[model samples]
Target: MNAELHTLTGAYALHALSDDEREEFERHLGDCEACTQEVRELTATAARLGLAVSVTPPPEMKAAALRRISTVRQEPPVAPAPARPVAARFRGRRMARFALAACMAVTAGSAGVAVWQHQSADDAQQQARAAQQQSEQLAGVLAAPDAKATTGQLAGGASGTLVVAHSKNQAVFVASSMPKPPSGKVYQLWFNDAGTMRSAGLMDPSQTTEAVLLSGPVDKASGMGITVEPSGGSPAPTSAPLALMNFATA
Candidate 1:
């Protein structure tokens, strides 16, 4: 059983093992805490590795894929925040946000091409790059220390909600429930520190959102608000927020 441990990894990390193999590994791990730790470490590492990649997974495999992610070797823990914060809490939270966003960024960015396939052929080749741009914008906004999460709308009807939170170092924005913007006019985002509003990024069509996460961090922002801008994005918002909220910090 000890010699067979290595054989169980690839399948175990992805949870692809047969019943007997899984049982054997479980029993082996019970007596050998080292094996349990090894498995956990390997899974975390795998998930982390996968996060940086953009492979659209099949639309139907969302749950299985997310579940498997938690078990992967290189991935970090993506569980909900705990009740207490530790010394490394900032670092841990940063890692968690990036890992989650990175993974979703790939999938959501490409719209089920990488996340579903991870890199398999048959996915969109052009890369729904437009969507990727939008996700990147969301990440940028979330990183603001004064960022807050809530529902929003543009003058035209672009709508969604993102959670904006942060610490002294940076502001982070996480969003979902955003409808993809209209064709010519995108649901653009903006950051208004005081009176001047700066372009954040384009919002994807809201219909595509799936409770996926979006994040970003920025400096020199005392307060923030999202607004609708032109398709290519404007240096400043052309219209007011369809849905707006104040930063908790602000």
Candidate 2:
């Protein structure tokens, strides 16, 4: 039973086996780690094939393929030697067919995985470029000659400065000293736009001193404030701000 089950490994991995054959193979898999590993790798490869983009083949592609096949010389089958047993020859042929089918399936699946990986790499590169451009824009705002800076202190002994570039409508928050928040809590920054409060960003409490880019247009904001919130942060201040700094109007 074990020897026969071993022969079904390729079929089992490709999910081509009958229910009974699959059940028997699974039972054998428990005692065979090599077959288990092969099946896992094959299954993952097959999953990658599902993620591949599908495209309609050109109308002429089938005709072109037939034309190429027609021109190829066909190999004549060689007669088996009289001394070779008929059953052994037939078994050899069956095993060869199974191996060929498994190889073709694996090759197609690998190609699909390669295409998916390439697309993922391209998406990551595009995201990195976008982040680099945003950083450069923020750096320009900080370098502006008209940028003004002011300091503010928090009740929890945390202090930071608000450096605003009025012309650019941007600001950078540089923490001179900030204590780490208790577990499950984080410090969040907000901009007071007139009477409405808008989220600027979250501050990293792990760092003693760090500069954070306050995203969004700052021209309309009259002041900035910070408050303790849950780790992921909140849309609105959940508690009273630890500190607040008002910007001087020119």
Candidate 3:
């Protein structure tokens, strides 16, 4: 594989490459298994990151946008030369109109970008807060006196451990060498309450091995199960369990 071409996987996944470069990379993908796998993973990651969680603009955002727009200086209209031919004067007028339209477009785009940046900042702050909360919950679960862990070797050379703390009503799944789900699919966790199964949470496709704090309380669940489900997960298990661990037997 061409080292330079291999490095374009990110750009190619985002469709940011030039036409010539895209064509060349497509050709390379046909013969390079590593590049093909990378492109698939990169494309999935980009799609996940591109999902927009709408955030309300701040109170002053509108005023700020207006202030930015007001800073744009418009060009004065040019007068056509009287001595020019009729066709030349007409063309000059059309050009002037086009230029004015372009300037207005640029001004609008600038304001839009400012608002977008503000919204993006808000989104990042919210994500950071959510992450901090999850970290604290994970720590609590880990510190529980009744916490118990079960480890098992899964198929495909993968292994995992399930840690549960009844006192905290929380459980965490730790995995190693877990295989990536198929395109448009994700690994989902389930809490087995008696004979019924309830959703725990969806795993991040970008991570194969990591500690995942299950979504809901697990005090009543007898065990935990993992299955391959469509992105965002399904209401019920759509396939056989990839792995299962009994909490009592841990």
Best by lDDT: 3
Q: How accurate is candidate 2 locally (lDDT)?
A: 0.62
Candidate 3 backbone collisions, by pair: none
For residues 136-181, write the lDDT of model 1, one tens digit per residue. Answer: 4434444343545544563344344444445533333333335556
lDDT of each: 0.45, 0.62, 0.65
How much is the lDDT of residue 127 in candidate 2? 40
lDDT of 1 at 44: 31
- Candidate 1: where is the Cα deviation over 4 Å? 1-165, 210-217
lDDT tens digits, residues 52-134, model 2? 32234589999999999989999999887889653354355358546744774455332112212223434444443443354
Model 1: which ten-residue window has the lowest total lDDT? 113-122
Candidate 3 residue-wise lDDT, 79-141, digit = tens: 866786533433433444434433432322211111112234344445434543665576566
lDDT of 1 at 132: 34
Clashes of each: 55, 0, 0
Total backbone collisions, model 1: 55
lDDT of 3 at 58: 88
